[model samples]
Structure formats: structure tokens, C-alpha cells
Target: MTPGMQIRLWLRQASKTQVGVTAVALAGVVVLLVASLTTGGHHRASTSVAAGAGAATNTGQGALAPATPEGGTGTAPVAGGTSGAAAVVSAPTTGGAAAVPGAGGTTAATAAGGTTGATGQTAGPLTASDRGVTPTTVKIGFLIANVGGLDQGGFALGLRTDIGQAIDAFVDDANKHGGMAGRKVVAVKRTEDPTNQGDLKAACDYMLRDQQVFGVVDSASNIYAATQRCYTIDNKTPLAHVYALSADFMTAGGGYDMTTTPNLDRIAKFVGAAAKQMGFVKGGEHVGIFTDACEPSNTVIRKVMAPAFKADGAATVDIAQTDCDPQAQTSQVPNAVLQMKTKNVDRMFMATSFVGVQNFLTNADAQQFHPKYFASDYDGMAADLFTKNFPPTQWDRTQGISSGYSGWLRAGHGLTPAQKRCSDILVAHGLPAMKDDAANGEVISQCDAFLNIMVPAAKAAGANLTRAGWAQASQRLGHVDVAGFQSCTYAPGKYSCGDSYASVEWRKEFQGYIQISGYRPANA
Candidate 1:
């Protein structure tokens, strides 16, 4: 019998007492794991280091109120003023514009072309003069993963912190460079649990309703769509870099995704292209698809990628669904591997997390089975376990489809100007610099959204900025160029910035991945 069969027989022959004890232990472990995953880990609220003269005030409940609006500096208060009272002057009801009370009870009017504030300055409809904007500051909130109760053990610990730091660093740099349109952007940080939908909603409520930020940005989490219900559906808050979740979040009236991480359908196309490149398009190749049912996006991967591969000439396409939780993946991966072995699959596509990928690779190695592996960006092909734990021989046969450029990969080829800018900002803020795939990817993705997308949208919005104005500005964007990466575009109806991808190959020597193909249209 094969090694896999031998292990299976041994597991079957185990005594009832031993099996019962092991099952009990696993149940207890899962309980502890679930408790940790569901609870909010750590909570912190602070003003961005770059707040400078217009530093934010920490309100109760981890909310940070915008800095005081300065007069004559062209800064205007919100319609209700700082006290949140009713406006002294009402907005225009007729064709002839009526003046409304602005910051500090200043009169402002919305005109045909733009908005005119108390200072008689006619700026674009979306400018620093709008809500959360002062001549010297613009307030934004960040709901990111950080500080779990356990000692750096939660999903949001290291990776989320790195992303937050990158955002802070970029804001600081922008402040030093005269800020966005002369308004220093202050980032109010709030910790969140990615696995807890309730926590995610609470974070959104605190940021949008309580804090009253001008706009929200960098809410990176696994269950990010849950937060969208609070911001997009309920509150209509303008969010930036909202591209990390499935396409279900991008309903007509739900929320807008401003970054170019392809939706499920686009990702399926990417996978299909990679499969063809890996010689899996031949009629005789048998393919196995592994998905984590716990992840909403995985449903699309299983349903969409399978058919795409089959149509590309995969003789037989078998799919396996598994739990994504790390502990559950431990047992699920082994059984899935056994099934794959039974079918003698020549290629395997993974729609799961790094943990599931690692476990399957371990079992495959033990069984002496080597198959061409395909995975989406969800696997995070960084220098983590795939480099330190998994054998290099296995990596050599692996291929990844990335929706965005990997900073670690770019750094290996020597930091581009954009990469250098990110590093410089991190160093300037006295934060730990990006060194690994997780850190680099987090920093790069956040910075790309902030600098390339958010900044430009704000600039286009002009000085009369409102949340609605910002959303309109983002929709008008087209062919936006990202430094050290591909260009993106945005339009009405379609919120995805760039529908392109880069085919990457695993390089054990670098302990990361390298792009074998430059950015191209996803369908191409």
C-alpha cells in the first residue's frame, strides 16, 4: 500500500478510547480558537503623527473629532457647525442659490459650477472647505486590524499593523509636502477583529457616525463586506480602497471599490489563464479545486474557476470544499489530499488561505505526490511558510495569479521610485520598514490607494468637498497611473480600477514570487 493508504489504515485502526480522547481535545481547542477569533483583540485610538498644527482630538469611544476649523485660511465648518446644531442659514431651494451656514457660522452657497464659502472663494464642489476639512487639516478614519488580546496571535496582529503604519507614513509625507490641497490629512486609527462581523460594523459606526470623518479609508479585513453594510448601505459614507472583498459588496447602491483587485469573475478569468499557461489546458489533465467555504470569495472561485478550466479542456474537474479556520484546515487538508490522490489529479487550484495551502503541501510531500499548483492572491505568496517551512522543490512547480503588484517581489528587483517612497515614509515616521511579503503587500496596497487613488480624487473634488462630492470625483477618474505598477481606471456602473493581472512564479532563492508577465487585461 502507498504511504497515504498506510496512514489512513492506521487512523482507522486506532482504539475507540484514543479516538474519543483526540476528538475531545480537538473540540476544546476549537472552542478556544473560536472565542479568540470572535472577540475584539485590542483597541486603540490615536491621532496621525502628521496631524501637525491641526491635530485631532480623541473623542469618547475611540472616535477622533476633526481639528478646529481656522477662519480666513479658507477653512469652513460643516453646515451645523462644531456644536452640531441646526444651520443658521438654509441651503438653496430655487434656481437662485441660497446661502447656508458653514464652519464658524460662515455663509456658503452651492452654485452651478462650484461651491462658494464664507470667504467668497469659488472652489470645486469637493474641497477642503467641506465636512472634516479645515484650511490646515482634513480628518479621515481608519478601521484596521491591530492589537488582539492574545500576544500577537490574531489574524490582524502583524499584517494589519504594517498596513496602518504605511498609511500613517504616507499621510505624514503628504503633510510635509504641503498636504492634500493645503489641508493636512489626519488619520484616526481604530483596531478591529476581521473575523467578527459585529466588531466590523461597530468600527464602521464609530468612524462614520460618531467620529464624523470627512471620508473613510484603509478598512482592510477579511469580512470587510460587513463594514460596507454600515458605511455604504446604511450611512452612505465615502470609502477608499474598497477592493478587498467579493463582488457581492459592489451592488449598484451598496459601496464603491476604487482599487483594482479583480472581482470573483475576473479572478476566475485570471485563474483560467494561468491554468492554460501551466499546460493544464490539455484534454487529458485531471484538475482538483480546493476551496474554503468559510470565505465568501471561495464560493465564486469554486463555481467560476472550475467551469473556466473545464472549458479550457480539463478532462475532469473535481472540487473540494474545506473549512478555512486554521485548526479545521489541519484535518480537512489531509482528507482533501487523500481524495486528490485517489483521483490522480495532475493540477490543483487552491481557493483558500495560507494555512490550508501549507497543510495540503505538507500532506502531499509526505505522500510523495507532486502536482502543479495554482493559487490566487488570497494565498499571499510571501516569504512566510511557503518559504521557511515548505520544501523548495514543491515551490518550483507552483504558480500564482496576483491582482496587484507584490511589493516584496518588486523590492527583490530593486525598489522602484514608488517603493522607495513607501520605505522613506515608513522610516520618516519611525515605523519598522517593510521587509517581508505580508508587510510589503500591506504597505504597497494601502499606499497605492492613498497616493494614487484618494489623493487624485480629492484633488479633483476641489475645495467644496463633501462625501457625495468625493464619491462623484472617484467615479470620474479614468486611466489612473500607479507608481511602480499598472495603471487603473474608474467609471460609473463599474467600480473596479484595473481589470488586469500579473502572472507570478515562485522563486525559492528569493523566498518570494517574481512576475513572469507584466500587467495585462484579465481576460487576455
Candidate 2:
């Protein structure tokens, strides 16, 4: 599809609300998963979407990688099967800018390798508490996609009522609760065209340079690597972003940028470990790995995948790389299917986007070869579209690891205490309670951007209140908790929030994904 078409398709439909339409959905790309949390690790990154119900799950801004991976900044990679400029991840995908967490492994020149002190402590210009801190309040900026022009298909994105009010609701509640370290939390929000460089640059300038907020909460904006660098690296600011992250991106962030969920680079490890524990990959099972041939993805084969499964007594493993070209990425699926059938492969690791996974499954079925499919839900695997649209023949009885988004979430079940508070907070703020709304994930994610990560970290920063202090203090959260999520673990070097993921399988009769297992360490 043309990039514009891809963007439009990514915009899923949602019911409108009075405040505005809180909608976002990728009703098309059905990456079979448990919510792979590429929603980045599910790969949709759970990117931010302004379409449909405001999906908060995969805005597909993880789609925000540059034309090519460069410098220190890493691609966002939203939902697994999500498509668009924001969530491309070097592979072809469908749907519009669903914040399908863009994929593509970029090398990081920053701190994953070398020990770093704190985020935003990199070499850069200095400002007072990263330029937006004050004694009485810490100014934080937020970047969200400007869906104004993208209001097609009758989905009127409620910029103010939904997005603005939702944010205000969170901010107001935080302040009422002693705020961040007893200081009122001030948030400045800016919207920019994710696909436009000028717009992105201007937005960054306004937030990073003009507003000089202490940090930024990035929802879904597949901005340039340089633009990202401007906010976190060069500008010495910090960001809590919702994108599928990688070690390289963490390095690019100078250890400053943090993904809301598990990172893409760790998907291999998470899936492998989760599979082994779930008995999906065990001794005597012939496993097949179908993945994109990219930097970190390629490395995942030997460095992460092999060891994870092999040590579990997997008899033999076959690896295949999907074509990386957006147009031809899945060209090899047929051959890969043939190989699976010929080799008697019984288990398959869908490391590529839902596009590639669906093709492989279709080709496999054509050959009457059905191997149990499992994945980490990246590249769109765990997206709502994946569960609803995926073929039951291919998706039924499959399971994987995910930190967030799944058939359960899509089914509008499983409300956590924290999620309940989100509703209450909204209602208290005089907004509609988004119970099963399409933008439910987006709104909740926005709340977590502060409630879960930024505010808590800022609180931990205490009076120091510098960007560096925020990064260092984040570890103070220790066993971080966020309802409806399996893991929100934090550590000094761990910039991503997801650590443990739950195992889930698809239920019959189109019930979508159901969790079969609880939290397990991704590194295990």
C-alpha cells in the first residue's frame, strides 16, 4: 500500500464520545499473540493512535523510526503487525499509522555497552533541572500525534476533550496526591505531524527549547532519530515514550529514553524464555524461527534465540530471514513454509510482523502443514486487529509472552485496580469514563506515562529534580506495579518498564487471547 494508504488503513474505527472520539484500533493487522506488548515487544509498541477509539495500545508511533537507523536514536516500533511510516521497522505492514511500533534494529553508540551514570547526563548543553524544573513545580512536556488532518472515516479525534482532558485528569489527580515529590506537576502538551520533519522539528523546538520541560512523555510519533536525539540526547532532556525500544535506542538516549513496555531487542529473549517455560519449545520439538533480516533481529537468531531454546532441549532449530524490503519482506514465506513442512518442524517462532506470520501460516496450511505458532507479539502480533482478524486455524491454541494488549484486552475484560482508578479519575475530572472504549489503552497509557513512570520517578528524584536525577531515581521504584500489566520492573540500566510477561493462548469461537500463565522473567 502507498504510505498514505498504509496510514489511513492503520487508523482503526471507534465509537465517538462527547468529549471527542477516544478511538484507536488496528482492525486490520492481526498479529496472532497474547498482546505481545510489541503493542513494541508485541511490536505495535502499542503505539499511540488518534484514530478509532484513541487505542493508547499501539499508537503506531513506534512507527517513528527514521528512513534508516542512525546515530544513537533507535526506531520506536509500535504494534507487531502495525504499518505506516511510524511503525515500519524496515518491514512492510498494513493499516494506517496505528503506531504499529516501527521495527528495524539500529546500533546504539551510547550506554548499553558502557556503564552510564544517569539519563540526560550525556554531553549536552545544560539548563536548570534540564531546563524546565523549578522549585515549586517540575514542567513536563508531552508529544502526541496531531491527528487533526487524519480525522478521516468519520473518526473525529477529540483533541481537547479526550486527549487534553484525559491528561488534565491525570495531572490534576497527581497534584492532589502531593504531586511529584511534594511539587505540583506541570505538563505542557504539543502535537505535531509525526510524518512531517518540519512539524516534528518545530514541535521539538517548542517543547525542548522553548518550554524547556524537565522531561517529555512521548506517546506515538515516528519522528527522526535526530529529532529524538534533540529531545533526549543533545538537549539533555529525558523522555518516557511508548514505543518498542532496543538496547541501541537506549544507548541513543544516553540511557535517557525509556520505553513504556518491553523493548524489541529483548523480544527474542522474552519469547524464548516464555516459550520454554510454557512448554511450547521443549526437547524433541523441531522449532522454526521466521524473522526479518535486520540488525538486532538478525543478531537475535544466534545471540538470543538459539541459546534460549537450545538449552531447553529443543532437538533442532531452523532459521529463516524475511526479506527486509517493505514490498518484498514476506517474499520468502512460501519457501519457509516448504522448509517447515519438509523438515517436520512442529513449532514456529513468528519474529516478523503479522504480515509475514499470516503469509507463513497461509502457505503452511496450503501445504497441510500446521506448526504451533508462538511469538513475542511484536510487529503487530498482540494488536486487537490481529486477534479479531487472524484465522482461527492458525491462531487457535497458540501462545506467547506479552507485557500488554491481547485478545483479553480486545474482548474488553480484565479491569485492574489501576485501570479502575483511571476511570474514576476521569469521571472525577468531569470526563466520560472510558471502560471499553477503543481509546481505552491510549488513555490508560497516557496516565501511566506519568502515574506509572514519570511521576513516580520524579518523586524519587526528590528536590534534586534534574533530568539526571529522574533517571537515577527511577530505580527507586523497585518492584513497580501497574494494574492490568504483568511487569513494570525497573533497574538502573533497564530503561524499559516490561520485564516479566504473561503467557496467553487464543480461545475457541473467536474468543481471542486468554492468559494461560502468569508473569515470568523475560531473561529467564
Candidate 3:
């Protein structure tokens, strides 16, 4: 039997044996659990670092208040304001040994005393002595936040999982088609404590130095800019980066280190746009935003809602902060929800993770308080998972926004050309589904805006993937064009691309199946 088959056989045989018969059985379970937990933690830390990086990358602070489902309207990411001009920024600059195209590119070895090119582009083709570069066998490390306790981090984690599933499908199909020019793409993961810098550093060190990964991808926060920039500069590992957070957050406080996915803000805007589309925007329309200051994602909700609340004019936006830990912060959210009800509030904008939102929705329902609930992508991802743990009441009240690429896949929206290519790869590989792919396609469109405008021009003189090459690759993306590919590009100075997020509203079939109902682009 093959090694994998033998391991499976051993596990199967061991399942029937008690510890009395084989102590190894008990050890195996323990080992698996520990490994899983460690991986999960690393992913979480990676998410935080990404969030912070975004925050550090921007220049202003605009807060958004949550909108209520009752009558208050919020704002969407329209193409006005300073976000359109788009700034050109350099990749994080670092000191390292200079690396030429072909010198030390053969193996996954970091050249000793090597200096990275100033281009800041995450990946470039350096002719290796080997046959050629293959997308398969190219393992990329994805670090995100998914620990159970933090709501924002947890939702982002769920989104990451969805993205991973898509990539897996894409690679499976690619291998069938003879792989990425003959190499199969494989993905690995790591998690870290999103709340701490030290943890973020530790996770990075392990993935980069120890694992010697080819590159790193993240659905990360802006807060992680410092570390991420450091890696980009030091490693010359071209990143297929996803700037999921909003441009507003990046500029907050002359640029703080707290960033998240742009989708988070876009989702919040959908809350407002949906309410307005339903005629909930008028004087005396009560809306409120609730965020867990203890969590970084909530900060994003507030930022997305600020200008939106001001723009709505008729809606009254109130802000409330909560603790990340629900058990310890019992009554904090329920009380806030009750306060909104007392004010005759009609809608709410939530900047919470799935677990936190699930709890708040349950508490609000038990109290017999009903209001139109709207949240960012953080809440939407766990919409299905929430049903498994919470009651049915939430299904009828909640609506949220998500990335177009992932949201389209999850809602079974029509596939684009790019998504189709990605899907074909999955089918060829014998993988189960492409329902959750979140990486690939025009996602790089968002990143392209930045890459196209960076200060020094990231493309090296002899670079294989030129600006034209990158742009052409991105243009081919369709909902079904490529299988589950949903990555954005990042060049030198500029970071965010203007691709707004897609929105989703929950519906109950009354027969126990709660699923996505109202879906659209939250623009206007």
C-alpha cells in the first residue's frame, strides 16, 4: 500500500482498538488535535497582522455608525471621495542580501545575506536551473485569524476556509490538465494570536524562515502592515495580497496599524444600501452601529458607517462598543440592542464576527425584540454556521455584505470565466466542490490599482511577469472564468483597488433551511 493508504489503514484499525490494546491510538488523537489547534492559532495571528498592515498603510479616519433594519439607512462604497484618486505607496522597505533572477532561485532556500529587489512585487519569475515553474507543487502559506473566542477574527477565518476550498479545487483541476505548466499548487496554513504583535512575528518567522515557503497570501487586516511590509521587502516573495479592509481605515489617525478586509466596509455599506432600496431612509429613521472595541473587525464596521451615516442624513446613527468575550460581556450586547429598541430603532449595522453576532441575535430574539439586522462580511460568512448553533429567528432579520468573488461562489451566483477555469481544475483533481473558492480572478483588480501606481515601479528590468502580463492575467477573470481564484495584486505605493463588496440578506424557508436571499452590489 502507498504511504498515505497505509496511514489511513492504520488509523482505521486503530479506531477499533482501545488504549488498553494500543496506547498508540490515544497518542494519535492527541497529536492530531494539538496540530490542528496550532495551525488554527497561526492563521488567526496572520489575519491580525494583515489588518494592522492595512491600517498602517492608509492616511485618514472616518467612522461609520451601524444601521438598524427598521428604517435607518447606511452608506455604500460609492466612487466619490478621496478613495478614487488612489495613492501610490512603496512596499515595506527592508535590508537583506541582494538576490539576482537566477542565482539562488532554484530551491526554497533564503539566500544567506541576500538583498531583495526594491520592486516590492511579491513574486517574479527567476529562471531556475530546473525545468520550469509549475503552479502545482508550489505551496503558498496562508495565515489568518480563526480562533473561536474573537468574533471578527473568527468570521475572517471562515472566509479564509471558503477561499482555501476554492484554491484546492482549482489546483485539483490544474493537475488534471497537467498542472501549472507541470507543477501542482498546494496550500498550507498557519494561525496566530491576532491581538499580539509578538505572536504575529512568531508565526511569520515559522512560515518564512522555518517553513521557507515560496510566498504568503492573506485575507488580512491593515494592522499587520508593518510586519507584512517587512516580509515583502526582506523576502522578495511576491505576494498575491488581498486588501480586504477599506481605504478609510488605512488612513485613520494619519494611518494606524489596525486594518481589515475592504469587504468588511463594503458589507456595512450594503446594510445602508439595502435599507434605502427598501425605502427605509427618511427623517427620524433610527439606526445604530454596534462594534466590539475589544476586536479589530468592529473598528472596520464603525469606519465604513461613519460617512455613510452622515450621507444618509435622515438616519440617526448611534455607536456602541462591546467586549470580544460574550460570556464575560453578558448583557452588554442585549442591553445595547434593547436600548435601540427603546429608541424605536429600525436597523442595525453590526461589525462583529459570526460567533458574536450569533450570540447577540439569539439574545435579542429571546427578548422578543425584532429589528432589521445588517452586518459586514464578518457576520455573513458564518450565516450558515450560525443557524446550526442559534435559533431560527436570526435568519429573517439579518443581512450582510461579502467579497464579490467569494459571495458569488457561496450564493451560487453565475460563474465568471475565471471562476470556471478554477472550477475545471477542481473537477480534474477529484476535489469535492468549488462552492467556497475565495482566491483568484479579478481580485487582483483591487491590488492592480496600487501595483500600477507605486513610486519606484515594482517590475524589475528582466522580470518575467511584466505590468502587461499582470494586467492581462487579471482581465481574464470571470465569476466562472477561473476556478475559485480570488486574489488582488499589490504593487509599490498604492494598495486598495476600487472593487466594492457584494451584499447578502438572510431568509428563512420556514421549513428549517435558512439561506441567502437578497443579493446585489452595494453601490449608490
Candidate 4:
């Protein structure tokens, strides 16, 4: 039996459920939210983020005026912008970028501690702007993970507060340095219940409609595609997402929505590449891929992942699906295990979310099946979701590829320039500097998106700060200084600027995951 099999079984019980509420309804039965979240409640006014905020509870001022879902929802990524991607920006910048000040003449430190800007292109907004931009303030929305009534303990205590402090501290630091386009960033904050689609849409609407934010920054909280659409598509606002955005969000966003992490296709592509690079999956091995039956997940499994494994020379590839049902996910695990075992799958990629990963890991062990696992940060593998559920084991031959940086992985190498700057800002605000992946690296992500990404992109927008200009300006940034990756590059359809993915491994000694290899390029 695995070391964590006992505890994993305990946590997998029905009593404790952060797996998220039913995302879809079938014949009056509730299911989904493994993806494909449901929005099936009675039509009510868009309430604020006070209803059942998760671990990161919302600190709402007041409920905004109720509104209805608007028409004209759209989709695609940088790699589809609002306009055609081909016409937007140049190809991505390769290798290290030299020091060039980000917009507003603010300097950014490179990996080697030298100063540089995200891009060298001299870009300034060409049109007049008035929406959410002011001479003194650039209002943006922050969607927080505020799970109402959940007892969030351990390093996750005050989850929302920590992120708030991290964001606020960065905002203060940015203002002190040279505000975006010479305008102070006034962030409009909203917390949402990640489990509830209604709350997700309401929170999104409040920010774009009531608060009139320039763009929405949500590094925490993974809600339904419809809610994401409410921002990037229906609202026609730019969004900086932590998770992968599907074609639904991207096409509707018209290239307005992007993840700070690698995109869906890039994630699957790199996982296969990383596994092969790590020798975890060798040529001719029968590989099994377990994924949720939802957009982005299943879509990439067929279009990106399976082909990737085959390209890596796998003899055969077996794809399995989880129906986004909490009960079905666990109940079907043994059968899935049977399939993998029967197929002699010794290399597997588990792309399921929190509950799915936890259940499968335990079941695979109980069934006497052990396969080297390849995962991504998107699986919530690096989050607190992993910390409490299980510990690393021999079977945890678990390795991952991610575009985002986590300080927990900065053991022998110390802090990167991006992490150091974020820590310093936190310390400046009387908050203890983050020394590890406490809060799973959410602080670093928020800092990266808000300070490094948004600040420069907004500045590139010049005196005007329209949504389209910001999206274009951000996508065009050739290279950027970010928290964890080797290089950060951007192009029209490639909205996220991660130029490389760092190979990480779950090390028992560190009690966390670490970067085991140097940077690997997206195209590599």
C-alpha cells in the first residue's frame, strides 16, 4: 500500500468536498465542474461575491446593481485576438532579451539581475481613451477565490488576505516606481465562490459592468467557461487568467483572454516532451492519459496530447475520460485502473483536477498498478490541493512542466529576480516575504500578472487604455521578466508570455516540487 493511501482514502470520502459544486444538470441530477460548470439557477439579479466564497472569501463593500447576461459572447487566444491573430504581432522573441525599460520608463531586472523591459518595441496608444482610465487611476478588477464558510487552515489561512496584501503591496510598489502610463492603478477587488457558476458570472459582471474595470486580473479561482466569457467575450474586456483558457473564452475574447501559465495546447505538448526528456516515457511504451470530459481538457487531449505522445514515439496511447461527476470520478477509477493495467500502460499523464487526481492516485496504488506520472500545474498538482491530499512516493515519479515560477522550487538557486522583487514589495508593506510556495505560488502569479504583465502592457497602451489596445500591447511584448520561467515571450495569438517551461519534480526531501531541469522552449 502507498504511504498516503490511508489518508488519501479519508480525504476522498464524501464528507469533505472542495471538488466544486455540480457544474451541469442532467434530468434534474447535478454533475460537472470537473469542468463544464452549470449556470442553472433561477434568473436572479447579479449578486456580489458574498455568496459562499471559498477559502479565499470575498471582502465585499456592497452588492452591485443587478444585471442580466448580455448578448454577443465570443472565443480563441493570442496565438486568436479580437481581430485576426495573423495581423496582430510579430513572431515570438527567442533567447534572452536585453535591458530595455518597460513602458513608463520603469526598469525590470533580467534573470541575471540586469535591468530590462518586456520588449524593446516603442509602443504608445494611438487613439484616445476614456473608459476605465483616468489621469490618476487605472481601475482593474481582481477576481479572488473566496469560498464562503470553508475552514481554510495551514499556510492557506487567510488566503484572500494574503493575495490582497501581495497585490496591494505590488500596487504600492508600482505607484512608487512610476505608475502605469503615469496613472495610479486602482484595483477593484471581487471574491467569488469557485464552486458556483452564478457567483462567477455575477462577480465578473460586477467588475466589468458596475466597477468598469479596464481589465480583470484573476490568478485565483477556476470557474465555468461561461463566467470567463462574461469577461473576455460578453464584456469585451481583457482577462489575465491563471488557468488555461479554452477556445470558448479565447474566441469570444477575440484574443482578449490569456493564461499566465502555458496555454492548453502548449501544456499538453510540453508534458509529453518533458516526460520523454525525463526518460519517464520512452519510445514504444503504451501510454495512458486520464482527463476530464470537458472543454479545454478533452479538446486538447484529442487535438494536442495524444498526437504529442505519438510524436514522442509511443507504441500506443490509451485515453480515458472522467465525466466531471464527483461520484462518477471516484467510482469509475477502479475500472479506469483496470484499463490501464490491462493495456500495460507504464507511463501516464493524469490531467484531472483536484478530486480526480487524488482519487486516481490512491486507486491506482490499491489496484497494484503503478505508472510513472506526468502532470501540469493546471492539475492543481502544485497547489495546496496537493499538499493536504498526499505525500510523494516512489510511484510519485511525478514530474511536471509549467510556465509559472514557484519560490518553493528555488532551493540551490535562491530567488529569481522576479521572486525577489515580489518579496521585497511584500516586505515593504510590513508583510513577511514569501520564502517558499506558501499559498502554492499564488502570490508570485498575482505579482507577475499585476506588476510585470499588466503594468507594462497598460503603459504600452500609452495615455489611452482601451481594452483592445491593452490586449494588443500585451501580446506584442517580445520578451518579459517573469517569476519562474527561463524566458517570457509574447506574440499576437500567444497572449501568455511564458517563453519556456521549466521541468519540475516532486522531491520528498523538499516536501514540495522543484525545477529539476533548465528551461525548455515552447517549440522545443
Best-fitting candidate, measured by TM-score? 4
TM-score of 3: 0.53
Candidate 3: where are CA atoms >4 Å away? 1-200, 211-214, 219-238, 241-243, 248-263, 269-271, 294-299, 324-331, 375-378, 381-383, 386-390, 397-416, 435-503, 510-524
lDDT of 3 by residue, 72-190 (tens): 12322111111112222121111111121332222221222222322443444333212112312344455543232222222221322343444444334433443221233344555
For model 1, the local distance difference test gives 0.49
**Predicted candidate 1 versus true structure: per-residue lDDT over 268-368, tens digit per residue:** 66678766875656677888876554423443454456777877888778766554333445566677777787778888776554445656677789888
Candidate 3 least-lDDT 10 residues: 30-39
Task: Put down candidate 2 lDDT per residue, 178-284, tens digits, no spaces.
Answer: 66654556777765654354455566667665665678776545333445555666666767766534455455454467656665556666766677777897688
Cα displacement (angstroms), candidate 2, residue 364, comes to 3.6
Worst-scoring 10-residue span by lDDT in model 2: 1-10
For residues 474-504, what per-residue lDDT tens digits would candidate 4 score against the true structure?
A: 7766687776445677666565545577767
Q: Count the backbone clashes (under 3 Å) in each candidate.
A: 11, 85, 128, 31
State each model's CA lDDT, in order: 0.49, 0.53, 0.35, 0.54
Candidate 2 regions exceeding 4 Å error are: 1-27, 30-129, 135-137, 146-161, 181-183, 192-202, 222-229, 251-255, 329-344, 383-385, 405-414, 437-439, 520-524
